[model samples]
Target: MLTFSFLLVIFLLTILLAVFDMMILDFSIWEALINLYFPEVATGRSFVYTGVFFGFVICIVGDFRLYKKKKLKKNHAERDGSP
Candidate 1:
């Protein structure tokens, strides 16, 4: 959950940065997304943008694994008649 929350914050910030680039820097939405994923075309924030996206994906996978682990634990506890 902590990882998810952190990634969520970074993702939101990335979105804001993209919007800022579009509004203030006159970048098209497509250009902004492309620049984020491709470092060669970006000024210098490519690492941050790419990291945020990949971190978001990792967060999702982590959350799913956590959920499954909790569910399995609960099932085991119920089967063993323990709290």
Candidate 2:
């Protein structure tokens, strides 16, 4: 469970960082970030718009499931007489 949680956090953080990098690229802010991770593609040659949109959807679903899981765990603990 600990290892899984650590990897999940890293995955979420990486996606979030990529999203941030995309947002900044719109206004051309953070050239260093772009150069380091996301090198420039040719003009009008892109696929990231769809990817970012799906990222948001995935994040929403992930959050909802995470909340549900926590809530379920809390209920189980309470049923077991946890203080």
Using TM-score, give the best candidate's number.
Answer: 1
Alpha carbon lDDT of each predicted model:
0.79, 0.65
Model 2 lDDT tens row, 1-83: 43355458867776677667668765343553455356665554356656755766677778778889999999999999965
Regions of candidate 2 where Cα sits further than 4 Å from its true position: 1-46
Look at candidate 2 and tell me the lDDT of residue 46.
51
Residue pairs that clash (backbone atoms under 3 angstroms), model 1: none
lDDT of 1 by residue, 3-75 (tens): 7698678679878878887988689987876665564755767677788778778888888899999999999
How do the predictions measure up, each by TM-score?
0.50, 0.44
Find the candidate with the highest lDDT and give its number: 1
Q: What C-alpha root-mean-square deviation, in Å, does candidate 2 show against the real structure?
A: 8.7
Error of 1 at 47 (Å): 3.5
What overall lDDT, based on C-alpha atoms, would model 1 receive against the true structure?
A: 0.79
Off by over 4 Å in 1: 7-42
lDDT of 1 at 81: 100
